[model samples]
Target: MPVPVPRQRDIPATDSGPAPQASLTLLVVEDDPAGGLTVPEILDADGHRIRIRSARNLTEATRLLTPDVHCVLLDLDLPGPGPGEDGLGALREVLRIAPRHAVLVLTGEADADRAAEAVRVGAQDFLYRDELDGRLLSRAIRYAVERKRADIAQYKLAESKLRAQENARLERGLLPTPLLEGSDLRFAARYRPGRSRALLGGDFYDTVRTPDGTVHAMIGDVCGHGPDEAALGVELRIAWRALTLAGLCGDDLLATLQEVLEVERPCEEIFATLCTVDISPDGRRAGLCLAGHPAPLISRPGGPARLLPYDDSGPALGLLPRARWPRRQVDLGGSWSLMLYTDGLIEGRIGEGRERLGQDGMVEMINRHLERGLSGEALLEASVTEARRLNGGELTDDVAVVLLSRAAGRTPAA
Candidate 1:
């Protein structure tokens, strides 16, 4: 049976202060022929009388061990272990039953070895019954609780670090690496996820130069913000790469991607916006395809940045069946730069207002950066960093930006 300890409201409050302390219920397991064990009234750090529940044996202890119990104090003197049996068998059982609670063990002075052994096993602390006092017991209880809390906190920290490392490895594999080994175009990209503590989002980009001397680059946004969308984006990027390597282009390539998106998406409402460009071998002309996506920005050495024509763009992938994305031809001149990006870049609010840094705003920002002699990787970093700055803080969407450039003296034919 369980017995409650008498409350002592008259005890002088300890230095730990007068703040109302949350009372901790301590379960005491002991066996005495005198019916119930007598424990000195103990007060917690905050001067509140510590509540106590006494269990005559392990059976009662187990029955009384509930989530509300904060600590367990076991008496190692309980009889049961035979000659060859472990002396701490009762303590071990208590630990197994209340693994999450702080524990203390009580033993006689002569059985000091057993007390030490009890602490080694799992008990937070052990006390010789002869040395038991209200003050000592109070401090021990407080110490044990704090130690257990620290242990649990350390374990959680280690677990979170392990999860982060695993996520980094997975993200490295999921994000595509540009394949521009023999191509003259200089490639650079930047990506950021809107999710707090996340490394990747639904935005993705890839650039590859095929054997036919045509460089294909793409950027897309899976219309949502999470791992599911990020996963879908990876799948689409890989599919596009494979189909491009196999010589598919324009509407044919997009049609196949739409089919893949429709079949693989989590639901029918899920869709993706995409912008793809196939630059010619001479870097003088290119094919542009926009699947309900923002047009790519183009900039030449002496001209202002502008958006490619989006008049013939088709509906976003997965939005309609048999949708045709007309591949429009655009002249890239000899020396030019193309920037393909997800909507996250332009969707951020400008100057803390309801107004967004739309395509026009983005174009103006890029031209400003270009005027300052920024190009390639420097240009991309500056552009994205500025967008985040203008938004007043981090943008709450996944952003991906890719830059492919042809220098004035460095042509593909050269």
Candidate 2:
């Protein structure tokens, strides 16, 4: 009597009419030349016929194992390729070949222990040859395929989380920390990167008080907005601090930095803009130098803020070989505030239009904030917040702003 094949529940039709179901293919690896083992006709849960292909050994099984084969069924009695006649070696070979595909092992009822061991060796499930039927095989294949997909997804999610944590640690280590101990000048700064979820950008800044009481401060920007550029910026900043502490200043310090930039930059086309200020011990005067960068804004007591001398600035580093960045003398007067910033603060759009808030506009905006008696960190916070508000959104570049202030006849905060 011919055994009747069981029918699965029919899949319902969608609004667009009967949806077509994809067929599943299975590969059977066994040593059955005399038709000793037989597979019953199988149907998927969606009532579609499941295709089956047979191979005599491991070698032939690999040839028939195409990407379309979603599941593999192996017989434990099959001989392995190597000399050792372990009953489960063939199963291991199948697993190595089809790491992404679902795998099943077949064994006799008496060898059920070996079949269970095969499952521990990476097979999705195991089956007894005497009990094998169309309905059971079909259900096992579907479960194995879904389990494999879930495993891959979980592995990828863990990998992504580990990468983000590593990046956070690296970026935090690279950020600058000021060395202004025993200095009278009040220091405050704000930094924001345009790249989403990034802790550092191409802009970098630092401030340090030398043993001779001269406080040196600097802020710079690399030409690009990538990890390579950010790394270059950090290198330049560390180099500057080392040289300044070693008693180098003015043209000599910048010349050495240009040399470092030339050697460390990724390409010849890459360049960096820089601004450096050396405040004297008395805090009434400063030496300024600009390398294709914006000038620092100075605001005196009871007066409007204005830009310092930038007419004698030199070309940006890596742009001109042997270029000279002349240091100009500026009088800050007693009790004044100096603000140094990058081009990101001024390059933001004024509104929905193409017009940008240039240097002149920045001067006016600072003056209004000064009238409101905003100073120190509050002033900086207001300035950056207003800049973003005026741009109608987040600025699309990296911003770094530093402010140093002094009060007449008032002792410096400890």
Candidate 3:
């Protein structure tokens, strides 16, 4: 049989200086110290000396198996555990100790069956003692190294693909699809994470039309920007939807949601801020509830944008078990657009100064967008984009915004 050829050398060449040659250190484990398993000093195709370190037993082999050792030449006939024990125990031990390194088994010419079994047991290749030579040994070591590298690379590629598929499934479940099929209300939302290339963060929002024809909307923020926080946000949004569909409203709904937060949070210090609005069936009024969160912005067809009352807002969820979120009535005149958002929208710095674009600044920004005849997705996009620009870069927090609009005479009478 023809021997395998070594691949092109990885050593770099230089025009102005002597070329660098590739080199490798190999560990050889055997039992016959008198057989003098010696061969002529070998050099790789690149003329670099190949270093060899010999070990008399598994104990010594392990001591020599440092990070610099690239491959192991194991003797299949080496003595293993006493009678009745696995005769190949030495080989098995080598495999377990140096899993990342390439391995080749050395055996007698008559032991073909045993050599083949060794190959199946993780050896890259098997060598017959009678045919061993410096040239063949060197070529085999190089080939084994390259093969091991290929195996590891393929494993990493498969792992990365699997993770990406899992992330896609998770993102789909986290993002909500509006339940406004029969309602005349218009809905739009935007979300962005501060983490680069991250799919989601702690910010979340949802909107659904109840059986009684009222539209319920919410936007919330968990205190951190991490996968755990994003997961908690998704859990909260799902629970809110389930409760709202079950006829829970106002204080009762908020109270139960706070319980969910307290029970599900990773730690006691973790908390979440939330804002919920239930619009009247006639589309002229709403019941607003805030839990340590900013109030929603409301703008009429001919009126300037302004914030709804936030003075009665309660503590954030998970802050105090007995905290209460009182629902307050607010008149959302006909033909109005109400925008609910997370703190990310207003926390961005206005300029180089330390001042943030607080509630007042955000109102002014929205009014300018409104004057430009922007509405729906266009308006929401402009608001977020401008915030990032004014902050000098992307905001280092999660931003979630939801806009609900109802036109005059568009809804069926309550």
Across 175-258, the per-residue lDDT of candidate 1 in tens digits comes to 778888777889888888889999888887888889988999988899998788878988998999999999999999999999
Estimated TM-score for each candidate: 0.81, 0.77, 0.84
lDDT of 2 by residue, 1-414 (tens): 111234444434342243234878888888877643445446677766677788888889899999999898888888887898665888888888888888988888999889889989988898887786777888988888788788778878998789778766656644677888777888888888877777778888889999988999999999888888888888999999999999999899999999999999999999999999999988899999999999999999878999998899998988998889899999988899999999989998898899998899889889999999999888888888888988998888989899998887766545
lDDT of 3 by residue, 263-374 (tens): 8999888899999999887888899999999999999988899999999999988888878889999998879999999999999998899999999999999999999999
Predictions: Cα RMSD each:
4.7, 5.0, 4.7
Per TM-score, the best of the predicted structures is 3
Cα TM-score of candidate 1: 0.81
In terms of lDDT, the poorest run of 10 residues in model 2 is 1-10
What C-alpha root-mean-square deviation, in Å, does candidate 3 show against the real structure?
4.7
Please give the distance, in angstroms, between residue 177's alpha carbon in candidate 2 and its true position after superposition: 1.3
User: Better model by TM-score, 1 or 3?
Assistant: 3
